[model samples]
Target: MKVKEMIKENNRLREQMTPFNRSYLEDMILVLRASRVDPLRTEELLLEAAQQMLIAQKKGNTATQVFGDDPEAYFKEVIETTPSRPARSKLNYYLMIPWTALTLLFGVMAIVGLISEWTTGSAGMFGQISLFTLLSVGLGSIIFIEMIMKWMSSLSDTDAPRVGKFNIKGFGVYIAIAVVVIYAGLYLSQLFPPFALSPWVSLILSIAGLLGLKFIFLK
Candidate 1:
């Protein structure tokens, strides 16, 4: 066979291979379309495909001939043709659970303090004022918590359950802290009045109460 004829034959085969390479690239794009993952995630995939296309072009394969030797062009086309990404929801309200729980739990504690003062008849004007403030703050906090819980319940089922549990647990923790603090305060006050609270006995009792709470919490 003549050398010129052999070269022509080679050229024809290369042209025929182009369509087959193009079809594979088309198939890849189709497979990517079928994927359930978000389109934004496809950026990396498109980049990889572009690199492969560039390599195929350099290798002088039929695939590169149809898609072109320029991987950047294919990457740009994929990016432009990609589906619009969905907007992410900002459910930051879930973050309010712990704060809500603390407020409600502390508010109830304040109301209890007020009642205790009233029953003992030892509360002066300042004490009454403090108690009233506590009662108001606590009641307001409870109302706020109820509102938050209702709103959360109406949104996501999974998130609502988790947030609800967090609020409950936080409230329980606050109550436990309150009980420990109150008991220690009462015990120390009985042993040493405020005027004489600087005494060694009062200091020891106060430290003992704190250490006891630490032990209880650890257990």
Candidate 2:
């Protein structure tokens, strides 16, 4: 199954678990997802675990009995053994987030433009997205990807689950670095001061780009 489908099936199966077992499974799922496991493999692992957990539940066994007494040790062992996905695939997955965000933003803007045209018999005056703003956005996306990888690496290096759980503590470090990159890009973009896409074009391009991203990035 695809990662998304596996995730859906996993969620559906989790509902059948006893409360205590479900809670235990969720912790494992979170740590596994946050680990260096490949996205496809992570979902595969989760689905498999959920299935086994349900079977165990029927047999009157707890998650701890099936998974381990200390889930953290299990998590560390798994991360140590499972190799991460290729850097290219990881980068593509991160890029999909900003691509989807931009697509939704542009689609909303396009709808607003249509509403304006109907009400006033004139097209809406859509503001151009500034080059500087785009630079900042692009910086944010890159910063997010870098921070996450750094956190995962930290967890792997330390073999500690607490090192980088949600990409929070180390974000300040990434932001400091991002500021420098953004300014450099801003200086270079001075050549095209007024460059911008129209509302419909932005929406169309966003949708097309998202399709490409889904095809290429999502496993």
- Tell me the spans in candidate 1 whose CA falls farther than 4 Å from its real position: 1-17, 62-219
The candidate that wins on lDDT is 2
| Per-candidate local distance difference test | 0.44, 0.71
Q: Lowest-scoring 10 consecutive residues by lDDT in candidate 2?
A: 152-161
Model 2 lDDT per residue over 122-194, tens place: 4445435666666666667768776656654444322234553555557777888788878777786786574
Best by TM-score: 2
Q: In candidate 1, how many clashes are counted?
A: 2
Q: What is residue 71's positional error in candidate 2, in angstroms?
A: 3.3
TM-score of 1: 0.20
Per-residue alpha-carbon lDDT of model 1 for 7-68, expressed as tens digits? 34434433443444534444454444434434445534644554555567667755545455
